[model samples]
Target: MSLTRLLPILGWARRYDRDDLRPDLAAGLTIGAMLVPQGMAYALLAGLPPEVGLYASIVPVLVYALFGTSRQLAVGPVAIVSLLTASALSPLFEQGSAGYISAAALLALMVGAVHLVLGFGRLGFVVNFLSHSVLVGFTAAAAIIIGFSQVKHLFGITTERKDHFYETVEEVVRQIDGTNGTTLVLGVASIALLVLMKKFVPRVPGALVLVIASILAVELFDLTDRGVKTVGEIPSSLPAFGLPDFDTGTMGSLIGTAFVITLVGFMESIAVAKVYARRHRYDVDANQELIGLGASNVASGLFGGYPVTGGFSRTAVNDTAGARTPLASIVTAILILLTVLFLTPLFSSLPNAALGAIIIVAVINLIDIGEMRHIAHVKRSDLIGLSVAFVATLVLGIELGILVAVVASMLVVFARMSKPHSAVLGQIPGTTSYRNVERFPEASVTDGVRVVRIDAALSFVNAQHVKKLLLGEADAISGGDVTALVVDCSGINDIDATGVEALSEILVELDERQVDIHLCDVKGPVRDVLRRSGLWDRLDGRIHATAAMAVDAVTHPGTLPESLRSLGIDERHDERPADTVDTEVSHA
Candidate 1:
């Protein structure tokens, strides 16, 4: 491989021209405008102060831009991952407290370490289990939880605890007398303005506008006396390098949370990176993405921020704005740095209700009801999976939601394998190849010859199903007496030790029943597997080169079964079919 291929920025930067500068500049600025408010809102969602979000955006973007593969993917804090970060750390430390912030920093370090390890091992294919449908369901479920979880903050209620969403909701309703009208009005106004901006003037950076307008409303109208809570003061200047305490007990507690963060955050990053790559007609190396993302996370942890990843929404805006290369992300980082230095004071007066509104509006894109409808229509079991994940996230938690989603995905996969495709075979009227007997009316058995097509690869998982189907077909045709069985081996991709054992058992049973087995058209790779395992050594029947060869073999005495010869089954037909039974294993 070329050195430039490994370092994509080298190739892209080599061709960088003044001609591409305009679009990249515009895209970077537009995305930067959007990122400012988004960064702050995501920080709040992650249960940190707004500045941590800005801290996450600055160095991570520059690091990923230099080392990452994608051209337009924007690296930052994302919605579901941010919520997951909050959930994972909440049990370990109090939200917005010093210990909580330290734990959050530690989590970022752990996430970075996991990514670097995976990238070094080139084990990026692990994210393949995060199916697109699962992501759709997970995002929609997260969106609902995020929107509802902020309800207490939006409505402005005082309570002893803000733990269970259902309980908090009950408290909010029961304590209606304690409701703060000013905060409610502020939330309602922000939501309405953000919604209107999203629907009508979406390119205007509605979050920024809402932030400014909400602060003005609070300050000009003196809403504090009416019970509107502000974020109060924020620290100015850049974050200094520091480390979270790494006590042995803390490490033990963090192991599970870190694992979840690694999986969930990495999967999110891969999915978004792949999308951006596809939209831009580029390719992605998931392993390289891990390195780039890992570097970003390490930067985040060192700079006093939480875990960050390739954000889908921000990347979309970046792509749509015509970002040609990762240069746009670099520019975005500079913008964030400028904001941290000069813009911190402006957000001090910004009401928390507006930030909550900004988060709610941004996550609305993740609520995809249509995907659920399509799943229900095309695959009802997947619909059940989606619903289960949705309910689990809302009533239970994100970790439970993913646990249920993975279980559902596994069940669906196993269910399909349990009923591996099988079909009866018969020759077409005018061609030599066999076809599905059920689909083609012309296909039918000639004399006592039988052809059985099994779709799945021969493995212990579905070997019994194939065995039962073959024996049942033999019983149907011969009433417990049969002369021969032909397996169209083009469909049998590979066989394992257990499958070979099962096949041996079947061969013995067929031998006792006076039935002979014939194999035809096995793939080269499968043939190699069989030869290496010495399966062909104790063979029970002749392996024919093709279906026609198998049929013709029975005509000759040397190839004919002992039962067929004794029974005086001598005649064979020359007729054939053009297309044979086609079968193959699906991708895992």
Candidate 2:
């Protein structure tokens, strides 16, 4: 593909037409309705005011719609991100305080930088480290954290500590005797009402209903007399744009936390983009997505808001609501802006407990217990990676959790291919192609030639392992039992700089050992890369027309060997998505 042709923005938007506007309008209205409650709930989850939530959904959504590649990805504050914001900022300042909000804005700036860098570099693949199992585990753990942290509000008890799950439970138990009956009653009622509405009202934005009911219940009962806290009077105005107070000391204090926020935000945003791309049957540009997401956060930071991204639930809602262009997101932003201008004070009586309840219910859905089971059954190592990430994230912190998952993923990949499968090959009795000799007992081998397959991409991570495997194979064939060698190159799909350098070293060793090396079945792309690698011209052997032809030539130089001259081999190879299918030569 040409570099100029690879621009995703041009590919999709250039073809967009007036026909796409209705779908965009429908999606905008649906997402706008959903965003109002969800945004406020997420803001509360992030330890911000409900109004700030409304602010985050507005301009950021508009920014992402303009710059993003996804047609339906909805940019806004989300549950997980808000929880992450709270975790990152709670220690630095009092929740809901001015300093905390400023920190949140600074965090958004950092997240924006991360996204911009990754997107430009096309490094979206970084999210692959957080596998499905790890994600499930982390989400489950976060749900528990969100639930437990809100217990104080549930009991109408004021406390100033952050032990996350266990400490919250301990604090609740210690204060159990002091729990206000009125507050507990309110909390319980809110939870139940929200659950019932969500279960039955499906498309009615259950959160909006629950919030209204909670407010009405609190006001009707004059719950403040019994010590229940409300959201208080929110400023009914659009967000004001400003920069975070950036003292060097402040930056020093918060840079580490900001990096964690950046990483988590990137992971989340890219994941949403990937999901939409797959669903819509269009390729998303990772680099451009980075820009879109970065721009959103940058915009959020400027507007007294925290870091934002392509929210999973909102994006799904946008897609299901029939968003056909990025315009839907922009319109959703307009809706939020209007809410900020008119409806902020309606939330003055919304109980913190209700917001917490919404967060807890939402986060609980993220944890996937069945996925852990599947990983444990199919791949214990991967399950371990997920488990380690979960424990680290819970016990250590958010930053450590993400770093551990990345390290674990890389380690798993390296360990598996370290001693990559190198095998002796021969022709099966009733087949014409080569197969691993160990797997096929009835196989034939050319008198002095052995074929081996290396099954993994070549890179610095496994280059040394390949070197060891090649040396061992050379020694194994050293009884002068093998003189000619053909490598089945079907499994080797990619090669890197380190791999080419390693191949050069390996070739030198093979030449010294007097084992002439040849390659066959190198796919077109892989072959082109290798040709550029300069390994082909320097090798002491040939690229075969076919593995079968190479085998026959090894057995018979002038005339076909008696064993092969009569029995013809299928030299024409067909490609399939399944793992390699090879016919072994008869050793019998």
Candidate 3:
């Protein structure tokens, strides 16, 4: 591997010109404008000091820019990761305590270590275990939970945080009488302003506007005396490098949360990276992304920060503003650094209500109702998976929600493969293509040939199922009149030992029924496996390039079964004319 492959900055810096700087500067500034309010809001979401969010944004963005492949991906404190941090640490330590901070830092370090190892081992494909449906369900539910979790802050009421979403909602309602009128007004007004701005002037940073307005209102109207809570006492200094607590007991408790964070964060980052990479006609290396994210988290841990990941909104903002290289992220980091050094005090009077409103607005978008509708229309089976994940996350808790969703996804995959789709294929008139007989009723099958298409890879889990399905189809056709059974292996991309055994048994049974088994459109790898397993010799060179060719050859009278041959049926002459056959098939 070249140095540039490991450190992407070396590759981009070699081609960096004055022309690239203009867009990078514009993207960087735009991302920075959005980052300030979001960073603070997400930090509070994680139950940490507001400065921790800014601290996380700095090194993570700089580190990922140096190592990540996606030029437009902006690494920072995202709402999901922050909510996960809060969920994991809330039970172990009180929010805003030194112990909670240490635990959060340790979790980041552990997650970073896992990402680094997976990246180095090139195990980025492990994320395939997390199905897209599960992700959608989990994200939608988590977004709702995060939004409701902020109700206390929005209402300026004190309530003990609960694990389940309903418990939180109940607590908020129970404390409704304690709601501060001024804080509620500020939060509601901020959310309304953000919604309007997003609809009317999308180019403007509405969160920044809300923050500025809230701070000015609090300072000018003495809103603090009227029960409107301000952020209060933000430290104006850069994050000092520090080591996380290395206590084994704490480490043991955090390992599970850390693993969850590693998987979820890497999945979120790489997904957004691949989207923009594909749109721009470039490929994203998943392993390299794992490394970049790992390095970022490691830096975050060493600098008294919690876990962080690439935020989709900020990345979209970076891309929309014309980011040409990782230089945009570097610029974002520099601006955030400037904020930590000199502008922290300006946020001192920033209202917590405004921060809550910003989080609610930003996270609500993650609940994709349109995606749910699409899934429902396309596949009802997926609706079960989505509902399980969404309800599990909302009712059980974040960690258990992910666990249940993963298990459910795996089970769904296994079930689908075990009962894989095998279709009785028939040729369309004057076309080489074959389709399912049940779907295209006008398509005709050869008189003495049965073409069965097993539309899944032949694996151990579905080996017997495929055999049974083919046998059932053959039985459904005339019992002993079909002399040639062509198994269309076009969809069978691979075969295992169990699949080979299943095929061998299928051949023996077909021979007993006085039928010759032919394999058509066999994939190269599957053929290689069959050859090695001695099934190729059993096939006796009956394989053909396509299903239609196999059927064409077997349609001859000489190839017909003894019973069909004795019936004196002319195989070459269709007893039914082409038009008549089409009409009969279509009506049937």
For residues 1-588, write the lDDT of model 3, one tens digit per residue.
688899989988988988989999999998998999999999999999999999999998999999899988999999889999999899889999999998888888888898999999999988888877888899999999999988888899999989889899898989999999988988899999999999999889898888888889998999999988888999988988999889898888888888888878888888888889988888889999999999999999999889998888888888989998999999999999999999998999999999999999999889999989999898878877788899999999999999899899889989999988888899998898889999999998877678899889998999888888877766665633447888888899999889888988988887787778887777768867876898876774366667876776565322322221122221223333343232211100
The TM-score that candidate 1 achieves is 0.90
Q: Candidate order by TM-score, highest to lowest?
A: 3, 1, 2
List TM-scores for all candidates, in order: 0.90, 0.82, 0.91
Candidates in descending lDDT order? 3, 1, 2
**lDDT tens string, model 2, 289-353?**
77888888989999988888777777777887788888888778887777777877777888877
Two-way lDDT contest, 1 vs 2, winner = 1
Across 1-588, the per-residue lDDT of candidate 1 in tens digits comes to 457755678888988988778889988888888888888888888889888888888987888887789888888898877888888877777889998888888888888888888887888876666666776787787887787767767888754344455665677688777777888888988999988987898677787788788888888998877788887777888978898888677667776667667777778777777777887788988888888888889888888888988877788778888898988998899988998899889878888888888888778878977867887788776776677667776677777777778678777777777678888788887778788988997885755567787887888788788787877765555532336777788788888777777777777877777777777777766666666677664552456656665655544424334232222222223122323212321110
Candidate achieving the largest TM-score: 3
**Ten residues in a row with the worst lDDT in model 1?**
579-588
Supply candidate 3's per-residue lDDT for 346. 91
Query: lDDT of candidate 1 vs native?
Result: 0.77
Better of 2 and 3 by TM-score: 3
